[model samples]
Target: MYLRRKPIFFLFLLLHPVFINAQFFADRLKSFMSTAAVSAVQYPKEVKEFYELNSYRFSWLEKQNAEQLALLSDYIRSSPSLGLSAGDYHPEIFPIAAIHENDSLLTEISFTDAAIHFLHDLMMGNKAEPLSYDGLKYVPACYNAAALLNVYLSPGRFANLLTDLEPKEAGYLAVKTKLNAWLKITSAEKYEDVAVAVSKTLRGNKNGLTRLYQLGFVASDTASLSEPALKAALKEAQKMFSLLSDGELRSTTVQALNVPLATRIAELKNTLNTLRWLHCVKQERHVALVNIPSATLLLYEHGKLVIESRIIVGKKSTPTPTLSSTITEVILYPYWNVPYKIATRELLPAIKRNTGYINANNYQVLNSSGKVVDPYKVNWRSLSAGNFPYTIRQSTGCDNALGLVKLNFYNPFSVYLHDTPGKSLFGLDRRYFSHGCMRLEKAMELGRYVLTGNAVAIDTLTEKGCLKNQSPITVPATEKIPVFVLYHTAWIDGTGMLHFYEDVYNRFSPGRKP
Candidate 1:
């Protein structure tokens, strides 16, 4: 009976190599993981789940393949070119030679650790240093380790997966190429201080023209170029910085050139991170993006840019909030419902000085119950800043604070995009004038584009003289455009030109070296 039982057990063991192999390798992996160079804390939760799902099978190690180890080594060493710190992944801790010491446990553990760290940094940008300011509330996308591993394990897809990990936007790729150029040339050339408007051309000064060539702003040999050629190069540079393009060495132009190369590189890094964050959204339909720092609005349809316009964002004290929402409707000659803070802090003093101010501006005072209250009935003298109990609303007209068109979106800040009567402000280089809303430069064009599919409503409103009428014209958007209001001080244009805007809110302080 004992001999018969032994043979049965041996047969059962021989038929279960799949389970036996998995159990044997899993035990070794668990033992190596306990004493691995990388700690458990360093492994993200998703990575742990990935290993559990695979039953601790080694992903990067195929019986200690040298080709796989070399690929990882090259990738880690090339991280700096992508504005990443290879040291954070610590690839040097486990040299290829050390990994190939013929100890399978050590080799497998090291290979897994290096591959996971490299992937983490590549997918999510090198975890940004703690920011000192809250001016930007954008959060970067994190990696799902299990999904990433699945992609890696799939045949003939690893290369594509690697390409997809980086930002696929043209702007980001252009900026990254520029970053590499900046790294190679290492320019310290700076312009001298000048007045607001300087009419001199860099061709007059041979040294200045040489510096321009070094900075890659000119197309040809700048040093030997004629005065007209030099002026054209300077004009191009001015345009790149969003200046007036007067082809002169103005103070603002000089200041832009004097910005250190290292500072520009840091801005490029921040822009790359921002691109990664923005690219995570898969929307390809009609969308509107408002770049706060640049004070510009861009509209895209089917992933193609259709409209670009200047905009006036909020001032430093009441800066616009970064958020994402959908524009559901466009209101023509809409009434401006004054916020409580604006009513008590900005307009109350004017009303006190002149009782007719409200009448002159077509404003009406209303109680909480929606009953119109006579302005004269309210004791202007007794209404302290805190004790004001009335809401001031501007009637619909050309003189309305919101101009002719207002874009309605769902946001807690109660901020919207609208036209402004202050048209001259749009021509200024620095346009931060609004309380919190965005003032569009070409508001009518934006309105026409958003109301494209609803042509009858727009035509009817235009025929009815909506602009001059006091009655509001509501146009329901047939196609809702997703609006993303974000702040990016640095970006690249479709022409592959690097554009840098002043950090008006001062969100990024580049103190930590990469």
Candidate 2:
């Protein structure tokens, strides 16, 4: 009985130092947290909660957790590929080589703080500040930082958890993959500016083909290629750049090519940030995604694109604003209720110049009582912008400025998607011609899509047309489709091809050139 007691006492002696060390660390951590210096921590709340949950255990200093710390450091260093700046996390301050016990405890707390920040930024996006013009309204996904660290701090879980926290959308992944690839390519290659010649053909130009090949626009840099092949490659490059795609190496194409790889990388980063901001749209079933920069509309039904159309957005002077809303009503042969500003500032001069202009353009002058008054009866020359007290409206017709269809959604900007009589403008490459409204090339088709089950109603509306005494047909959407007017200058298309557009609104850094 004495020998057995002796062995048990020795076992207790072996565990005593371990317990003492843990208690010492816990007390020191508590004292450190109580000090005002803890206020300097980037994520003080999350750090405190994390340490409290573990009873102030040294998470990063433990021998078994070294691999986890190393993995976290790698992630911090590589954050730029994820559209985050590594400097934000301050990886340099991490005590990777700390030899002192106090340094180790401080390192543990700092690691937890930085890890929480990185995880929060990774999940909820780094750009929390709102842009005045971006009109981003959706709330990002929320996460408990302390809870995440508690679950994912183990050796085997940390790396996988980092990957899992990243955005899983295909578009985002594609851009990330491209960003990494570009990082590697730009590191190895020194790309020189390709000179643009207004009169010379770039078909046999070695410098042009070399730059195009480097950009993945052309298959090869061989100058012996045929004119047609070179032209086709140039068109492909132009398409990717959102240029005219006329198969000519014009100044715009040269400008796009001359844009440095660093600028392209920055553009890609901006695109990644934008995509993360719009991550909520992935859950939406039916959506009308109007990319303002690309001047295109993509209608998605249950996450699959059903309709793609060219669109005319606002000109630079009156850029279309980014906003999110739902399509509620569709109108066929819609009346153009000219805004007071347009009436007094734009059309009033025309009315004054020729009283017959109003009748020729199918415009109706409405008095304060909502009665259509004759434009000829009013003394047009006598009315100035400030004195104008009437409304001007274009009657419903094929020739109406609103064209044949209008999709209305409630917004403070009073902007809506509509058809335009100026169909020829849609054929142009740069379709920025509207006055802050979106002009859809397939407005009638969009109306049909919105009123899917009401085919008879669509047919009846089409037959009615712009006939006199017939009011415009109005149909409410059965299932309201969410519309997101976004401004993304860079994006990956459905074909997995990367494309860049001119920053039409000059919203981003390095504003659009003349």
Candidate 3:
């Protein structure tokens, strides 16, 4: 009994070192607050205290030579990165396993269990929902990408979004490409029986694998599935799914089963005949493309539109042209140019009357060949408002129409998204206030997103030298990422009550008649 007591004494001493060391770090943090006024919108103090205690526990575990405890400590120390608490594994914020049914064969499923456990923990509310850093700040971002998919598909299931593509139209269209690849692996040309068995297991299982399979197939851009084609597709999916761990799959298996089977799939006949079934209904963008009442921008992802605030858009006289585009280039310090229309109508008339008018506004005179002519060398009065064929380029620096940054995308309209120095508009409920470019409130966050992501370490296009005119770099996405800019006059807020915003663009109710 005396000998046993000695061992306990030894353990106490081991933990003493960790306790003493951690106290110093905690004091330093408290001292920091003394010197500075605390920042507004800070996280709860309990959060900070928990992390500090995690450090102390980590030290104590390390001294005891407990590797598992030490690892747990490490996770606690880096809780922000792990998105977990000390010795705690939340079981609900995410999914346990995700079962995707094979597309080609109507009865097969693809299982990915590795990542499901972590996701399942998050979804169960066992852990803190981690925040995502959006450039300059952080906000509550979803921990589970799969859960995001669930939220995404909630309003309208997979088949409903693709009303444009008929079941027979799956040959080479971009929308059908994803399905074609998936079908190649799932149909089991390589092992037909295995494919059928897999599908049967998913459908028969209570876990919703069948629905996932259905969703995956519907989201794809394929028209038909053959045994060989589907087998090939599943092979690819298997490779992608292998990245997760077994424990994860076990956790989210339940969430994977929760999906709404979606309206009457088996009833769609043409899809069955082609060894493929696709929903033939589509919801138009008209409803999503309208405006809100307040002065803010309505944001959208995929086809589902949600209005956050009301915003101003370019006047229709010089209306913003709608087109397919992505942010390609982001200029840190931007230059403004007098658009051709403005030059021809506004500046040209002034130049014809007052010679010094061009100099006063800092507009540079340029010839037809795009060469800058000295302001003094050219006869400003010689150019008539109707003959304003020459270009008027604005110099860089302050007072430029565009703020400090501008995002460029390829479009026939030569329009670029940007930030404006006129912050007054942010307060106005009616914010439709641009010539013809997107003005973003969260432009910095957009920049951060564009800069971070996966890229192939292929050939270095350019090894050295400063790269100006930074063109848009296309990053092939492994998962579906949707972006939408929309306008809605009415939407449900947190309390689910309908809210309205000012339709500054007048796109919602044309002429504001309603």
Candidate 4:
């Protein structure tokens, strides 16, 4: 017993240092968190009182602005934990800055839309550091002021907002600046109370033929939409329509609505009414692929999922056929397989540039039907452009258009994932450029993401489509991955707010008013 006790005592002595260090680290983390909480508690009231008196004083709330001051005092007191601070929460500065500068018209738009959008985007998983600074530093003061400005500046587009001013702009903008964008969205008033009423007002402003014309425009463009977001927007619009009576919208009493502005507004609203409420703003915390409107691919990295990424998709006309797809494989140094369209359309033209266009590019032509045609016997130019048979294949080398990688997926459409030389387009808001094949922005990382049980490999394929290789429809991979192209502009998020994005495609979808 004594011998066993001696050994146990020795072991504890050996382990004691590690246990004490862990406890120390744990205490350090707790101390920092506690300190952060304390710091956050200090200055929100100063922020709130400051926000209200300056912006809402002239609006409808002006008659009672002073009476309402104490109501926000409690909220103002709790704001530090909310991240409001001095060199910090100078609330109205952002919009005023834009207004004062006059250069950033985009920011000139009611800052709440942008601010709320930014917050929602952050919550949905976008990087939030820049937004955090802007929100805390610029939004509180900017919120009500910007809301007033959005209505004031674009009355034609935002006339209904005059009613929204009733709610405390400080509370509204607080949600906008402090919360994530997704959460702010769900903060909308009940649909029947707000959405239906707005729709009725906008629609009532128009006459019959104009309304039909608007619906006609919506029906014509459903083709541009990919599922889910469009479907959801349509759902919300229809519901909003039913909530208000036809008479309410068409009441002959509303005189100004009968003007041309009302007609256009009605048209846009009618089209907007068709959008459905799909699962957008993925607060569901899903890891699925998201397609964007205006026809681009978005990978929801964080909560808001609005990162501008580059992708090469099918070209227009012979345009990469549009359809839903998921990412499945990542290949390095991908060999280019001259697409059937490219083989027939582009190769011959290149050969004219030089017979070597084929030999030099590692591409060889096939003849009349499906058989390989000799480059020697055919009068390449005289051949009818439409009926030409051969295929082109390139032997692998450095000049391959596919560049260093490929991400492949299975789609009935014969479309696959690949890399491109154009790296610049990824940063654009509109990324509709591509030829049926999907291009990746982070090829290497995406490749590693989808790779399966194979040797954790990063191998490159050298069989350039320019060569004489078998033109198999499917390149059997040792593994497959899941990649999808989705379009989600709004939905209840983790915080349960309906987040919205710009209807980039404008395809039969609109951000239905809250």
Question: Local distance difference test, per candidate?
Answer: 0.68, 0.75, 0.37, 0.37
* Ranked by TM-score, top first: 2, 1, 4, 3
Output the better candidate (1/2) by TM-score.
Answer: 2
Off by over 4 Å in 2: 1-39, 43-58, 92-106, 128-136, 142-149, 189-206, 217-233, 244-247, 300-306, 325-333, 421-424, 444-469, 472-482, 494-496, 506-514
Ranking by lDDT: 2, 1, 4, 3
All candidates: CA RMSD (Å): 10.0, 8.0, 24.1, 23.4
Estimate the overall C-alpha local distance difference test score of candidate 1: 0.68
Residue lDDT tens for model 3, 418-444: 656565677654455677666666544
lDDT of 4 by residue, 423-448 (tens): 77776644656655666676544454
How accurate locally is residue 262 in candidate 3, as Cα lDDT from 0 to 100? 18
TM-score of each: 0.76, 0.80, 0.36, 0.38
lDDT per residue, candidate 2, 1-514, as tens digits?
Answer: 0111223223432333232366787898898998887877788988899988888887765545556766677777767767798888856663243235445556667878888888887776677423333343566665787888878985578878756777776777878877886676667665454544443587668877777776766666664777788788888888878788888777878878767667777878877876665555655667788888888888877556678889999999978888878889988778888988889888999888898888888888999999999777898778987898899988877688888778998788889999888889888878898889999998877888888787566677667665543467788887677788877778666554668887777776463331
Error of 3 at 386 (Å): 3.9
Candidate 1 residue-wise lDDT, 269-321, digit = tens: 77765555554332356778788888988877765667789999988899988
lDDT of 1 at 127: 54
After superposition, the stretches of candidate 3 with alpha carbons farther than 4 Å from their true spots are 1-312, 453-483, 491-498, 502-514
